[model samples]
Target: MNNSYFWLRCRCNEDIVLLKDPKSDNRSRGKAFIYPKERSYKTFEIKYSNKLSTKAKFILSSFNNKYIYYAIDDLLYLLKSNPTEKENLLTVLYSSILALHNNLEINFFDIWIDNIYINEIGKNNRFFKVEEQSQTLTHITLTLFYRTRSPFKKPEAQW
Candidate 1:
C-alpha cells in the first residue's frame, strides 16, 4: 500500500513539526513504530493504527518545545554519500559485537539499523554542525533496550 507522510505543527508553537501518516482504513497493522521521518518502517506502523488516539500519540506534548528543524541531517544520512564513513560505522558495530562475544547474548531487531539512532538531549561533544552552527550532534543518539529473565526456577521454600 502506498502511504504518505505530512507535517503537523502544534498550536502552541508552529515551529514544532510532527510527521504524521495518512489516515488508514480497515486494513491496518496493530503495531506502531516511532522514529525519524525518513525511517519509513515506523511511519507505516503508525498509519496502520485505525484509532485516532494512536495517531495523536506522536503529537501530544505538555511543553512549548519546537520540533521543527530547517535541516534534520545526521550521520546516518551523511553515510549515504560517504562509503568510507559507512564502512567505518559497520566495522565499529561489528567490533562491538565481537568484543562482547563471551559476555552475554545480543539480540538485534529484524532491521537493526532502523531501530538504532534516536534523538538525545543535554550536553554533547564539541563538534559543531556545519549547517546549524549553533547546534551540535545532539540528535546523533543511540539507546539500547534490553530485558533480563532468570533461566532457572527457584526451589520450594523451607517450612
Candidate 2:
C-alpha cells in the first residue's frame, strides 16, 4: 500500500516535489499506484520509476516550492473586488483544482468534485460540457464550465 512514488506539482506555483527519493527528476522517475477507498472509490499511490512524459516535463519547468492555498486566497480577494471579470476568476478556480489533483498520486479521485449534470448546450453538438458553480465574494452566483467530460460515472443508485 505504501509502495508507490509520486512527482507532485504544487497548485499555487507548480512547485515539484519528488516523494521518497530526492536525487532524481520528479517526472519520469516514479510509479503511481491506485488505491481503493472506504467505498468503491480509488486513489493513487506513489512508486519510483524512470519514465517521464512530455506534459510532466512541461509542468516540472515552472515547479515551485509552494502550494495553491495561498494563490486561492489571493484570487478570492480579487474576485471579491472585481465581480465582473469572469475569465480571471475561472482561471483561478481551475488552477486550484489542478493543484489539488496533482499531489498525492496514491489517491485515485478526480481533481475536482464529481457532481456532473447533462445539459444540451447545442442540439447539433449533442454533448455536455462539465460545469461547476461557486459563490463569489459579494454573494453573487459564479458558474464555471469546462468543455470536457470525465471517464468515470458512478451508478445511479450510488447517487
Candidate 3:
C-alpha cells in the first residue's frame, strides 16, 4: 500500500504535516479507499439493526465558548492519555498523538470532538465503539474489515 501526506493544525496553534496511510487523510488525496482495505485488525462489525437516532445528541452553541473549549480540551486529553490499538480510533488518536508529540497543534476549532460520529454510522464504514462514562473519559475499540484495494479518485470528491 502506498502512503500519502497532508497537514492539520491543532488547538495550540501549531501546524502538523506528515505522511500517513492514505485511507484516513481527508484533504487533497483525491481518492477514497473503501472500508475493509488494510486496517482489518482494528475494525469491528456491528449488526445493522442496532441503530441510533440521527437527531443531534448534544450541541455546543459555539467553539469560542469557554465551557465548550474546556470540554473539548478535556476530551482530547482523555483520548490521548489513554491510547487504544483500534485503527480508526487509533488513526485519529495517533494522528493527534504525532502532532502533539512533535509539538504541532491541530486546529481544534475546525473539528468538533462532539461532532465525530463514530457510533452513528452503521454496517460497512462503521468501524468502532467507544464506551464513555458521564460523557467524559472512556474506552474505545476499532474493528477493521479485511479487503484491500486502491480506489481511484472520483471527480469533485476529496478523500
Candidate 4:
C-alpha cells in the first residue's frame, strides 16, 4: 500500500492536510499506538452551523495572517534554544485543544511537537514597512492525527 500525505489550502485560507494511518485496521493490537482508546471510540459527525464560538474566534484571530510556514523541524530546535517561544507555542496548542473540547465535545488524541508546524512572520525585510520595525514572530498550527469522542452518558452514581 502506498502511504502519502499532502497539504491544501481551505476556504478559510488555512492549510488543511489529511494524514492516514497505515495500520489503522490493527489499531487495537498495540499498546504504544497513537490511536485513542477503544472506550473513547465514537462516530465522527458534523453539525452544520453558521455560528462561531468565542473560543473558536480567539483561536482563529491568534493566527490571522501573522505567520507563514518557517520549517518542519522548527519546534524541535526551539525547545532547546528558546524557552519563551516554546511556551507560547504550547499555550496556543493547549488553548486550541481546550476550545475544541468545550465547543464541540471533541478530543484530539495525538498532540506532539512533530504534529505542529511553525510559521515565522516579520522575518523578511521586503515584507516590512518603513514605519514598522521588523520582529520575527513564531506561530504554530497543529494537525490532528487522531481524534475520538465518548458516548454522551450521565455520570454514574457512586455509593
The TM-score ranking, best first, is 4, 1, 2, 3
Off by over 4 Å in 2: 1-65, 90-96, 99-159
lDDT on C-alpha atoms for all candidate structures: 0.33, 0.34, 0.34, 0.44
Q: Give me the candidate number with maximum lDDT.
A: 4
Angstrom error of the Cα, residue 109, model 3: value is 13
RMSD, model 1, all Cα superposed?
20.3
Residue-level error in angstroms, candidate 3, position 114: 11
Q: What is the TM-score of each candidate against the true structure?
A: 0.26, 0.20, 0.17, 0.36
- Give a tens-digit lDDT track for model 1, residues 27-129: 5466543333332221111111122121122222210122111011232353456555445444444443333333444332212232333232333345756
Candidate 3 wrongly placed segments (more than 4 Å) = 1-69, 72-98, 103-119, 124-159
lDDT, residue 16, model 1: 67
Over 79-122, each residue of candidate 3 has an lDDT whose tens digit, in order, gives 45333312233344345434433443323232222222234432
Model 1 per-residue lDDT at 146? 29
Q: Model 2 residue 44 lDDT? A: 21
Q: Which candidate, 1 or 2, would have the higher lDDT against the true structure?
A: 2
RMSD of 2: 21.0
Which is the winner by lDDT between candidate 3 and candidate 4? Answer: 4
Candidate 4 lDDT tens digits, 26-142: 555555444334332212222212233333334434442222122213433535455554555445555655665676676444322224344445545766676665455544455
Q: Which ten-residue region of model 1 has the weakest summed lDDT?
A: 43-52
